[model samples]
Target: MHNIMIICPDQSPLKESEKWLSRYGFHVNTSATIEQANRYYEWSEFHLLLIDQDSIASLENASSLLPSHLRRIVLDARPSLSTGVDSMAQGAIYYLPLPTDSETVLKHVVNALEQHDDTPQTDEATPSQQSDEDAFTLGTASSGIIGQCAPMQALFSDMRKIAGTDVTVLIRGESGTGKELVAKALHNLSHRHNQPIISVNCAAIPDNLIESELFGHEKGAFTGASTSHDGLIYAADKGTLFLDEIGELPLEAQARLLRVLQEGEIRKVGATQSTKVNIRLVTATHRDLIAMVRQGLFREDLYYRLYVMELLLPPLRDRGDDISVLSQMLLEKACQKHKRPIYHYNRAFDKAIRSHHWPGNVRELENAIERAVILSPPERVEAANLKLASHQSSTQQGTATLTQQGKTFTGTTLDDYLKYFVQTHQSTMTETQLAQSLGISRKSLWERRQKLEIAKK
Candidate 1:
């Protein structure tokens, strides 16, 4: 069991958190203040500190006073990019945003303790000390899915809870939030772990062939049916059938799917007999099915059936500290994959990522990292190598957006360009100073922060 000391002022959240962590098999203790927490730490060998964000200014002081073995994690009620960066600078190894669920807290605490225990004492490659190849392997193994942010932690908990059940699940998220990964994780942990999992992309299949693709057609069922074959659903009998981009499923196919769910059977095209299939169904889509149902694009009944257990994945830009961790991991992986010398990323690179909004989420970030790794020279990676702003919408193309008075940018919208400039330069300038530099009122700057979805300093 891992030992954790939570320093929080609010009794309600503290009690709730402690109760849940205890149930999850953790040795949890709590203090109302940092001073009291330090006293508790001196007596007990706690492996981690879960400090409230209110005491964040004192974090560095606490770290200096605590034993070297213990790691500090800040628990912010409303975490953001600015606070996340500051916490790391204050010596926090991890940041947990609120209102986080209990399961996410448990996972982060456990994982942090495990990593601390595994760290080498001497004469070994630490995270900063590891080479490209070693860092790629170590980071990937240690940071699978690349986040401990509140949203991701909640998603992890949901996956764990539903893994043992056979109920159908509908995962909803943006295009690159890794919905397919969640499906695979569910199958891997379910009773059908040993059974084969058949994955099909509904949008990838042509509308004319979708029926034949899902429900096998008999030989000569259509003009080109050369041989009688089992469908994907048939192939997945006694296993799992994962339908990705399920919102793109045709109406005719939706009716067929509804019948299969209702009767536990599938009828092949042009076949007289209906075949019984004992398989678990998992579907995912980035579109809103409810809205589609109202628009007559998707069947209401089918939508309800698939929506039995809805899991909404938070977008990448919302996961505060995760971007930094994931970027490093991706950079290392890209370097190792291409057999290039690893390039170290400086604070400027980190600032660049934190400032920009990731519209394409994880997929876009990985591509950017790979591009940088391939193009950058040996030694270190600079912000110019990232080229993230080039991915902005076409409407913003060739439009000059100024930053820091004379520094003009193109491609990205004014809001995004301003966010990038502010976040990158925040460490050097105060809010009032930055607002003045941009030639905008302080209130206007605050309004921009809200409009652009930026975290306040």
Candidate 2:
């Protein structure tokens, strides 16, 4: 089930929404006060969040100040993303008008977390699984997100709590953190598990059409309105809606969303009558929402509405457990997907995966494994067989830029870069780590040192 937090000054509507969410298998926490919301953020990790528009305004910088990868659903009085489109574009995943019926809203929540693409239906597809949905089959994100690091242990615990309730969750972090996976885990465990989980990328969607995409339209609603249409929010009816990259939503849409959330209704494009819905909302983003609010690019009220129970996903580097575990998992999946028999990596290859910073997190790890498997023989994956551009270049004279901040000695030999990189990650390396860092055999490493006229450590 999902753990949801509801933050609203209006208790009656929030209570009713909680009850409706309960029907779908969610555990919800209700908090009207900012203090309670702050307390919840400190100790809990919620999967989905439902916020009153006014509350969003109040908690402007709350999510930006929190950790990363939180899923949130917002109830806007204006019920549009125009005003706070920057918020969604910055990183909150989905922004929708608060629905009157809890069930309908729950559907939206499900849709938001599950449906990012429209997949053509296949005859072989089962009834319980949607054609285009990419959900992780409930509770599976926990499998990949865990880490042995204490920070990760604590983070996972928080995630469990976040997943346990329906709270407006704001996730803040650098790019490549495990935010989306955390959001999915929350939806899987929530009361609204049976419905679809839909997601929208605020940063990816064009600004002009975002409003129409969220609230839907009646026939003749816009220039291309050939027929009546249901937007992302309505598609997620009876489900969980995940808005990723929420910080980027445009300012005008944010105002409309604020109104819809506050009033618990939405007026679709070209439709005078408001249609009621039930849904659980989850939002995620990598930007600093509070910072944007301060800059006047985000609506302060909308920020408060979404800050009820923010959850942060630690980066892969911060979660060492994920490094090894994810490598192994991706290795297997890559082998299977590529029809390669290679399963085990040589010592050099294993060390490479562990040592890399994994700037793209799990996504990066998966790609690395796929590349290795694709290049390997049918029965084995070895270090040399792997095609890492970094590793390949390191073997040559080229250097790889490892971080931001323009700290670069571009012409330095690959060997120097490796030494620098290894020195930087001393915690992950032991005194005998040079061979591993260079992805070469101990004997070959010595040969390279002599051939390249390199100084031995």
Candidate 3:
């Protein structure tokens, strides 16, 4: 049995967690203070440390007091993006918001311990091997995706496990969350790496041409089909076919795609015979596909086929310090692309980046960095160069005080505020725009609308 230490204030919930962990047969120790934690650490060999925010004065102090060899998990009673980022920066392997159930906590602990055990001991590794391992840990894995945050690290781990298999994958996230990157990484890591990976943007293609483009056409099959042509599906034979924005595909096209997936073959328009193809299907969408299926816009059969394996990408706001890391990486690339000298950004630029809720995710960040690189002076980039809109300014303008019937309301309650803001803005703004303005997910907005009986305009 492995030894584990829990550093937390004498809270009932955490104590309950301790009991649950002990029931699983692991040797567990609980410390109520930093001094006590240090004492326990010196007295016993612990493989993992679970520290709560209230146990120490600050993350910096907690990080300093903990041993470097032990895998650390930080729990926060009140979690925010900044706090989570700081905890990760302090070398915690995981940062979890508290009030989570013991089962969830146990799952994280088990996963962390398994990861620790799987890691090769570096004491006897050669310098080159150590360097390679360090690079992988730093998010320089063969996938070439950059991320050091716990969510991304976990995503990379999942990718490695799923890449070797031939199952269909559905990548889902808000736009600009790098779904394509995940799809590309999967193709690069799969057994069909040598085969061609064809990408199709279903939304970008004209509906009239989508069928012909995907399934091909025989000579004189249609007015535009002057010559026989192979479709994207056939082009991806023995390779991978990536269908981005699959949610936008027409219902007719969806049926044909479903048939292709089921039969592992395709027949061109007006073709008498079917052509066999062996390919992996990977799809991505920023839209709510289930909602589309309900509205009868998307085929349910295709949805089920694409849902074999789902990979969800966390948006930029939830990714914490990855914003800083990605910004710096994008800055260098932007400078090189524009043929400009490397330029540093001021603290104001950094603050603006951290403050803004990037609804566009990494794509927005890259555009902002490139814009700043092109517009800023040779020495430093300023907040103005980024051209980011102030969320606070918008909120202030929208939430101004109102008075009626000899009484004044400042929107004290969350429901009142949401009802007022959403009802007031739903007339002029689209659903997506309203969600972005309110700093919430579209699903959350819809749920709130249902709860408050606020109908969409």
Q: Which candidate number would show the highest TM-score if scored against the true structure?
A: 3
Look at candidate 2 and tell me the lDDT of residue 187.
76
Q: What is the Å distance of residue 394 in model 2 from its true position? A: 7.2
Cα lDDT of model 3 by residue, 1-457, tens digit: 8788887888635666778788998789888877877655563377778888777644556666665556778887765444555666555666676777877688778867877673323224477654533333324423456675668877888887898798999998878888888888888877898899999987556668898999999999989788998999999999999998788688888888998899998999889999988999999987788887798887888899999989889989998757776776677779889999766644588798999888778887899889888889887876787877643345455454676445455754476778887777667887779889889987777656544546443
TM-score of 1: 0.61
Segments of candidate 2 deviating more than 4 angstroms? 1-148, 389-457
Q: Write the per-residue lDDT of candidate 1 for residues 258-361, one digit (tens) a residue.
A: 99999999999999999999989999987778877898889999988888788888888998767876777677778889998766656788898888887778
Order of models, best TM-score first: 3, 1, 2
- Candidate 2 root-mean-square deviation in Å: 23.1
284, model 3: CA deviation in Å? 0.5
Each candidate structure's TM-score, on Cα atoms with residue i matched to residue i, is 0.61, 0.55, 0.62
Best first by lDDT, ranked: 3, 1, 2
Model 2, position 130: C-alpha lDDT score: 36
- Residues 20-88 of candidate 2: C-alpha lDDT, one tens digit per residue: 677777777788755677666642356666666566576667555323344556566543223334334
Model 1 scores a C-alpha lDDT of 0.74
